[model samples]
Target: MEALVAITIGTLTAVGLYLTLRLRSFPVILGLTMLSYAVNVFLFASGRLVQNQAPIIGSGETYADPLPQALVLTAIVISFGMTAVIMIMAIGGFLESGHDRVNMAASDPADADQDDAEEGWA
Candidate 1:
Protein backbone atom coordinates (compact mmCIF):
# COMPACT_ATOMS: atom_id res chain seq x y z
CA MET A 1 0.00 0.00 0.00
CA GLU A 2 2.82 2.36 0.86
CA ALA A 3 4.55 1.67 -2.44
CA LEU A 4 1.34 2.26 -4.33
CA VAL A 5 0.76 5.52 -2.53
CA ALA A 6 4.33 6.59 -3.23
CA ILE A 7 3.96 5.85 -6.92
CA THR A 8 0.66 7.73 -7.07
CA ILE A 9 2.14 10.75 -5.38
CA GLY A 10 5.13 10.74 -7.71
CA THR A 11 2.95 10.50 -10.78
CA LEU A 12 0.68 13.32 -9.64
CA THR A 13 3.65 15.55 -8.88
CA ALA A 14 5.20 14.86 -12.28
CA VAL A 15 1.99 15.54 -14.17
CA GLY A 16 1.32 18.65 -12.14
CA LEU A 17 4.78 20.00 -12.94
CA TYR A 18 4.40 19.26 -16.63
CA LEU A 19 1.04 20.99 -16.83
CA THR A 20 2.36 23.90 -14.80
CA LEU A 21 4.98 24.54 -17.46
CA ARG A 22 2.40 24.79 -20.21
CA LEU A 23 1.74 28.07 -22.06
CA ARG A 24 -1.93 28.29 -21.10
CA SER A 25 -3.63 29.47 -17.93
CA PHE A 26 -6.09 26.60 -17.64
CA PRO A 27 -3.40 23.96 -17.61
CA VAL A 28 -1.45 25.94 -15.07
CA ILE A 29 -4.48 25.96 -12.78
CA LEU A 30 -4.94 22.23 -13.22
CA GLY A 31 -1.28 21.60 -12.49
CA LEU A 32 -1.49 23.59 -9.31
CA THR A 33 -4.56 21.64 -8.26
CA MET A 34 -2.79 18.37 -8.93
CA LEU A 35 0.21 19.51 -6.93
CA SER A 36 -2.06 20.35 -4.03
CA TYR A 37 -3.69 16.93 -4.22
CA ALA A 38 -0.29 15.28 -4.17
CA VAL A 39 0.66 17.26 -1.12
CA ASN A 40 -2.59 16.31 0.63
CA VAL A 41 -2.03 12.65 -0.11
CA PHE A 42 1.50 12.82 1.14
CA LEU A 43 0.40 14.46 4.34
CA PHE A 44 -2.31 11.88 4.92
CA ALA A 45 0.08 9.04 4.20
CA SER A 46 2.43 10.34 6.82
CA GLY A 47 -0.17 9.42 9.42
CA ARG A 48 0.08 5.79 8.38
CA LEU A 49 -2.33 3.64 6.36
CA VAL A 50 -4.53 1.53 8.56
CA GLN A 51 -8.10 0.44 8.79
CA ASN A 52 -10.47 -1.13 11.36
CA GLN A 53 -8.64 0.82 13.97
CA ALA A 54 -9.65 3.48 16.42
CA PRO A 55 -9.79 7.01 15.01
CA ILE A 56 -9.00 8.52 18.37
CA ILE A 57 -6.55 7.60 21.10
CA GLY A 58 -8.70 5.70 23.57
CA SER A 59 -8.44 2.15 24.91
CA GLY A 60 -7.17 0.97 21.52
CA GLU A 61 -3.56 0.02 21.20
CA THR A 62 -3.12 2.29 18.23
CA TYR A 63 -4.98 5.33 17.14
CA ALA A 64 -4.76 7.34 13.93
CA ASP A 65 -3.00 10.66 14.04
CA PRO A 66 -5.54 13.43 13.86
CA LEU A 67 -2.96 16.03 12.96
CA PRO A 68 -2.50 14.83 9.42
CA GLN A 69 -6.23 14.80 8.82
CA ALA A 70 -6.53 18.36 10.07
CA LEU A 71 -3.61 19.44 7.96
CA VAL A 72 -5.17 17.87 4.88
CA LEU A 73 -8.44 19.68 5.50
CA THR A 74 -6.62 22.97 5.89
CA ALA A 75 -4.66 22.37 2.72
CA ILE A 76 -7.83 21.57 0.83
CA VAL A 77 -9.50 24.80 1.89
CA ILE A 78 -6.40 26.82 1.02
CA SER A 79 -6.00 25.19 -2.38
CA PHE A 80 -9.67 25.79 -3.16
CA GLY A 81 -9.42 29.47 -2.29
CA MET A 82 -6.23 29.87 -4.31
CA THR A 83 -7.75 28.10 -7.29
CA ALA A 84 -10.82 30.35 -7.18
CA VAL A 85 -8.68 33.49 -7.13
CA ILE A 86 -6.46 32.24 -9.95
CA MET A 87 -9.48 31.32 -12.07
CA ILE A 88 -10.96 34.79 -11.65
CA MET A 89 -7.65 36.41 -12.57
CA ALA A 90 -7.19 34.14 -15.57
CA ILE A 91 -10.70 34.84 -16.83
CA GLY A 92 -10.16 38.59 -16.51
CA GLY A 93 -6.86 38.37 -18.36
CA PHE A 94 -8.34 36.25 -21.14
CA LEU A 95 -11.26 38.63 -21.57
CA GLU A 96 -9.04 41.69 -21.59
CA SER A 97 -6.39 40.28 -23.94
CA GLY A 98 -8.64 38.03 -26.07
CA HIS A 99 -6.18 35.19 -25.50
CA ASP A 100 -5.58 32.57 -22.83
CA ARG A 101 -1.85 32.33 -23.32
CA VAL A 102 -0.23 33.26 -20.02
CA ASN A 103 3.00 34.62 -21.36
CA MET A 104 1.49 36.77 -24.12
CA ALA A 105 3.97 39.03 -25.76
CA ALA A 106 3.26 42.53 -27.08
CA SER A 107 5.22 42.02 -30.27
CA ASP A 108 2.20 43.05 -32.37
CA PRO A 109 0.74 46.25 -31.03
CA ALA A 110 -2.10 46.25 -33.59
CA ASP A 111 -3.56 43.01 -32.20
CA ALA A 112 -4.37 44.63 -28.83
CA ASP A 113 -6.30 47.42 -30.45
CA GLN A 114 -8.12 44.99 -32.70
CA ASP A 115 -9.15 42.93 -29.68
CA ASP A 116 -10.39 46.03 -27.88
CA ALA A 117 -12.41 47.17 -30.88
CA GLU A 118 -13.91 43.72 -31.38
CA GLU A 119 -15.11 43.66 -27.78
CA GLY A 120 -16.57 47.18 -28.16
CA TRP A 121 -14.42 48.24 -25.22
CA ALA A 122 -12.49 50.84 -27.21
Candidate 2:
Protein backbone atom coordinates (compact mmCIF):
# COMPACT_ATOMS: atom_id res chain seq x y z
CA MET A 1 0.00 0.00 0.00
CA GLU A 2 2.76 2.41 0.92
CA ALA A 3 4.68 1.43 -2.18
CA LEU A 4 1.67 2.18 -4.35
CA VAL A 5 1.24 5.60 -2.79
CA ALA A 6 4.92 6.32 -3.21
CA ILE A 7 4.83 5.33 -6.85
CA THR A 8 1.79 7.49 -7.46
CA ILE A 9 3.43 10.50 -5.85
CA GLY A 10 6.58 9.94 -7.87
CA THR A 11 4.67 9.60 -11.10
CA LEU A 12 2.65 12.72 -10.46
CA THR A 13 5.73 14.74 -9.66
CA ALA A 14 7.55 13.52 -12.77
CA VAL A 15 4.63 14.17 -15.07
CA GLY A 16 4.02 17.56 -13.50
CA LEU A 17 7.64 18.56 -14.06
CA TYR A 18 7.50 17.38 -17.67
CA LEU A 19 4.35 19.35 -18.35
CA THR A 20 5.65 22.42 -16.53
CA LEU A 21 8.59 22.51 -18.93
CA ARG A 22 6.28 22.68 -21.96
CA LEU A 23 6.35 25.79 -24.15
CA ARG A 24 2.60 26.51 -23.99
CA SER A 25 0.82 28.28 -21.16
CA PHE A 26 -1.99 25.74 -20.87
CA PRO A 27 0.39 22.85 -20.31
CA VAL A 28 2.23 24.85 -17.67
CA ILE A 29 -1.02 25.48 -15.86
CA LEU A 30 -1.89 21.79 -16.03
CA GLY A 31 1.53 20.90 -14.73
CA LEU A 32 1.12 23.22 -11.78
CA THR A 33 -2.23 21.63 -11.03
CA MET A 34 -0.67 18.19 -11.14
CA LEU A 35 2.06 19.33 -8.79
CA SER A 36 -0.55 20.60 -6.36
CA TYR A 37 -2.33 17.27 -6.55
CA ALA A 38 0.89 15.45 -5.83
CA VAL A 39 1.55 17.69 -2.85
CA ASN A 40 -1.96 17.13 -1.51
CA VAL A 41 -1.57 13.38 -1.81
CA PHE A 42 1.78 13.44 -0.12
CA LEU A 43 0.49 15.59 2.71
CA PHE A 44 -2.54 13.37 3.18
CA ALA A 45 -0.40 10.25 3.24
CA SER A 46 1.79 11.77 5.90
CA GLY A 47 -1.15 11.71 8.31
CA ARG A 48 -1.92 8.03 7.84
CA LEU A 49 -3.06 5.34 5.40
CA VAL A 50 -5.08 3.26 7.82
CA GLN A 51 -8.28 1.58 6.70
CA ASN A 52 -11.42 1.35 8.83
CA GLN A 53 -10.00 3.73 11.39
CA ALA A 54 -11.97 6.48 13.03
CA PRO A 55 -11.01 10.08 12.45
CA ILE A 56 -11.37 10.93 16.13
CA ILE A 57 -9.25 9.54 18.90
CA GLY A 58 -10.89 6.91 21.12
CA SER A 59 -9.98 4.97 24.22
CA GLY A 60 -8.82 1.82 22.46
CA GLU A 61 -9.11 2.41 18.74
CA THR A 62 -6.67 3.89 16.26
CA TYR A 63 -7.57 7.20 14.74
CA ALA A 64 -6.42 8.83 11.55
CA ASP A 65 -4.84 12.23 11.97
CA PRO A 66 -7.15 14.99 10.87
CA LEU A 67 -4.65 17.81 10.54
CA PRO A 68 -3.23 16.68 7.25
CA GLN A 69 -6.73 16.26 5.83
CA ALA A 70 -7.53 19.81 6.79
CA LEU A 71 -4.29 21.01 5.31
CA VAL A 72 -5.07 19.23 2.06
CA LEU A 73 -8.46 20.89 1.91
CA THR A 74 -6.91 24.29 2.43
CA ALA A 75 -4.31 23.51 -0.17
CA ILE A 76 -7.03 22.58 -2.65
CA VAL A 77 -8.68 25.93 -2.19
CA ILE A 78 -5.41 27.81 -2.52
CA SER A 79 -4.43 25.87 -5.62
CA PHE A 80 -7.81 26.56 -7.23
CA GLY A 81 -7.36 30.27 -6.69
CA MET A 82 -3.81 30.11 -7.95
CA THR A 83 -4.93 28.30 -11.08
CA ALA A 84 -7.61 30.90 -11.71
CA VAL A 85 -5.12 33.73 -11.40
CA ILE A 86 -2.63 32.00 -13.67
CA MET A 87 -5.31 31.33 -16.27
CA ILE A 88 -6.37 34.95 -16.25
CA MET A 89 -2.80 36.06 -16.67
CA ALA A 90 -2.31 33.60 -19.49
CA ILE A 91 -5.41 34.83 -21.29
CA GLY A 92 -4.33 38.42 -20.90
CA GLY A 93 -0.89 37.61 -22.26
CA PHE A 94 -2.40 35.77 -25.21
CA LEU A 95 -4.70 38.68 -25.97
CA GLU A 96 -1.87 41.14 -25.91
CA SER A 97 0.61 39.00 -27.85
CA GLY A 98 -1.70 36.90 -30.06
CA HIS A 99 -0.01 33.76 -28.81
CA ASP A 100 -0.31 31.35 -25.90
CA ARG A 101 3.35 30.56 -25.75
CA VAL A 102 5.14 30.76 -22.40
CA ASN A 103 8.37 31.98 -23.93
CA MET A 104 8.99 34.36 -26.87
CA ALA A 105 11.92 32.34 -28.15
CA ALA A 106 9.96 29.11 -28.15
CA SER A 107 7.57 30.33 -30.86
CA ASP A 108 8.22 29.31 -34.46
CA PRO A 109 10.42 31.73 -36.37
CA ALA A 110 7.79 32.20 -39.06
CA ASP A 111 5.15 33.01 -36.46
CA ALA A 112 7.51 35.42 -34.74
CA ASP A 113 8.13 37.16 -38.04
CA GLN A 114 4.43 37.37 -38.65
CA ASP A 115 3.87 38.86 -35.24
CA ASP A 116 6.62 41.35 -35.85
CA ALA A 117 5.01 42.32 -39.12
CA GLU A 118 1.61 42.68 -37.48
CA GLU A 119 3.13 45.00 -34.89
CA GLY A 120 4.63 47.14 -37.70
CA TRP A 121 8.15 46.19 -36.64
CA ALA A 122 9.18 44.89 -40.11
Candidate 3:
Protein backbone atom coordinates (compact mmCIF):
# COMPACT_ATOMS: atom_id res chain seq x y z
CA MET A 1 0.00 0.00 0.00
CA GLU A 2 2.82 2.38 0.80
CA ALA A 3 4.56 1.47 -2.43
CA LEU A 4 1.37 2.07 -4.36
CA VAL A 5 0.91 5.42 -2.70
CA ALA A 6 4.47 6.36 -3.49
CA ILE A 7 4.00 5.38 -7.10
CA THR A 8 0.82 7.39 -7.37
CA ILE A 9 2.49 10.44 -5.85
CA GLY A 10 5.44 10.07 -8.15
CA THR A 11 3.13 9.90 -11.17
CA LEU A 12 1.27 13.00 -10.00
CA THR A 13 4.53 14.91 -9.53
CA ALA A 14 5.73 13.88 -12.95
CA VAL A 15 2.51 14.99 -14.61
CA GLY A 16 2.55 18.24 -12.63
CA LEU A 17 6.11 18.98 -13.70
CA TYR A 18 5.14 18.41 -17.34
CA LEU A 19 2.13 20.66 -17.05
CA THR A 20 4.10 23.36 -15.24
CA LEU A 21 6.42 23.69 -18.21
CA ARG A 22 3.64 24.51 -20.60
CA LEU A 23 3.19 27.89 -22.35
CA ARG A 24 -0.08 28.74 -20.61
CA SER A 25 -0.83 30.13 -17.14
CA PHE A 26 -3.90 27.96 -16.37
CA PRO A 27 -2.05 24.71 -16.96
CA VAL A 28 0.80 25.97 -14.80
CA ILE A 29 -1.60 26.73 -11.96
CA LEU A 30 -3.21 23.32 -12.32
CA GLY A 31 0.19 21.71 -12.27
CA LEU A 32 1.15 23.61 -9.13
CA THR A 33 -2.05 22.38 -7.44
CA MET A 34 -1.35 18.78 -8.41
CA LEU A 35 2.22 19.07 -7.22
CA SER A 36 1.03 20.47 -3.88
CA TYR A 37 -1.37 17.54 -3.46
CA ALA A 38 1.39 15.06 -4.27
CA VAL A 39 3.74 16.77 -1.85
CA ASN A 40 1.15 16.72 0.94
CA VAL A 41 0.54 13.01 0.48
CA PHE A 42 4.25 12.33 0.26
CA LEU A 43 4.85 14.27 3.45
CA PHE A 44 2.00 12.50 5.20
CA ALA A 45 3.43 9.16 4.16
CA SER A 46 6.77 10.02 5.72
CA GLY A 47 5.30 9.41 9.15
CA ARG A 48 5.17 5.70 8.32
CA LEU A 49 2.28 3.45 7.42
CA VAL A 50 -0.42 2.94 10.03
CA GLN A 51 -3.63 1.09 9.30
CA ASN A 52 -6.83 1.05 11.34
CA GLN A 53 -5.35 3.22 14.02
CA ALA A 54 -6.13 6.55 15.56
CA PRO A 55 -3.58 9.20 16.30
CA ILE A 56 -5.40 10.19 19.45
CA ILE A 57 -4.84 8.05 22.54
CA GLY A 58 -8.14 8.64 24.28
CA SER A 59 -9.38 5.05 24.12
CA GLY A 60 -7.59 3.21 21.37
CA GLU A 61 -5.29 0.24 21.32
CA THR A 62 -3.11 1.76 18.62
CA TYR A 63 -1.75 5.21 18.25
CA ALA A 64 -0.26 6.51 15.02
CA ASP A 65 2.46 9.13 14.74
CA PRO A 66 1.11 12.58 15.33
CA LEU A 67 4.11 14.38 13.87
CA PRO A 68 3.31 13.49 10.30
CA GLN A 69 -0.30 14.57 10.66
CA ALA A 70 0.80 17.88 12.14
CA LEU A 71 3.37 18.39 9.41
CA VAL A 72 0.90 17.57 6.67
CA LEU A 73 -1.71 19.92 8.11
CA THR A 74 0.82 22.72 8.31
CA ALA A 75 1.91 21.98 4.76
CA ILE A 76 -1.69 22.06 3.55
CA VAL A 77 -2.19 25.50 5.06
CA ILE A 78 1.06 26.79 3.66
CA SER A 79 0.15 25.38 0.27
CA PHE A 80 -3.13 27.27 0.42
CA GLY A 81 -1.27 30.51 1.05
CA MET A 82 1.09 29.75 -1.82
CA THR A 83 -1.83 28.90 -4.10
CA ALA A 84 -3.54 32.16 -3.25
CA VAL A 85 -0.41 34.15 -4.01
CA ILE A 86 0.10 32.33 -7.30
CA MET A 87 -3.52 32.88 -8.29
CA ILE A 88 -3.19 36.57 -7.54
CA MET A 89 -0.02 36.77 -9.57
CA ALA A 90 -1.61 34.97 -12.52
CA ILE A 91 -4.75 37.06 -12.41
CA GLY A 92 -2.83 40.28 -12.00
CA GLY A 93 -0.61 39.40 -14.92
CA PHE A 94 -3.57 38.56 -17.12
CA LEU A 95 -5.39 41.72 -16.14
CA GLU A 96 -2.34 43.89 -16.63
CA SER A 97 -1.36 42.42 -19.99
CA GLY A 98 -4.65 41.02 -21.26
CA HIS A 99 -3.13 37.58 -21.85
CA ASP A 100 -2.24 34.41 -19.93
CA ARG A 101 0.83 33.34 -21.84
CA VAL A 102 3.39 31.80 -19.52
CA ASN A 103 6.61 33.75 -19.11
CA MET A 104 5.43 36.24 -21.70
CA ALA A 105 7.17 39.15 -20.06
CA ALA A 106 10.50 37.37 -19.78
CA SER A 107 10.19 35.81 -23.22
CA ASP A 108 10.14 39.12 -25.07
CA PRO A 109 13.57 39.94 -26.43
CA ALA A 110 12.76 43.61 -26.75
CA ASP A 111 11.81 43.77 -23.10
CA ALA A 112 14.91 41.83 -22.17
CA ASP A 113 17.08 44.18 -24.18
CA GLN A 114 15.46 47.20 -22.58
CA ASP A 115 16.01 45.70 -19.17
CA ASP A 116 19.62 45.03 -20.03
CA ALA A 117 20.05 48.62 -21.19
CA GLU A 118 18.45 49.90 -18.00
CA GLU A 119 20.67 47.70 -15.90
CA GLY A 120 23.75 48.86 -17.82
CA TRP A 121 22.77 52.47 -17.19
CA ALA A 122 22.23 51.77 -13.49
* Model 3, CA-based lDDT: 0.85
Q: TM per model?
A: 0.84, 0.82, 0.80
- Residue pairs with colliding backbones in model 2 are none
| lDDT per residue (tens digit) for residues 1-122 in model 1 | 88899999999999999999999999999999999999999999999987667678894888888889999999999999999999999999889778898774667453444565557452
lDDT of 3 by residue, 70-122 (tens): 99999999999998999999999889767888864666553445556546542
Q: In model 1, what are the clashing residue pairs, if there are any?
A: none
TM-score, structure 3 vs. true: 0.80
Top-scoring candidate (TM-score): 1
Residue ranges of candidate 3 with Cα displaced over 4 Å: 56-62, 105-122
Question: CA RMSD for every model?
Answer: 4.7, 4.9, 3.4
Better of 2 and 3 by TM-score: 2
Off by over 4 Å in 2: 106-122
Report the C-alpha lDDT of model 2 over 1-122, residue by residue, as the tens digit: 99999999999999999999999999999999999999999999999798777688883478888899899999999999999999999999889778898977735563436655557463
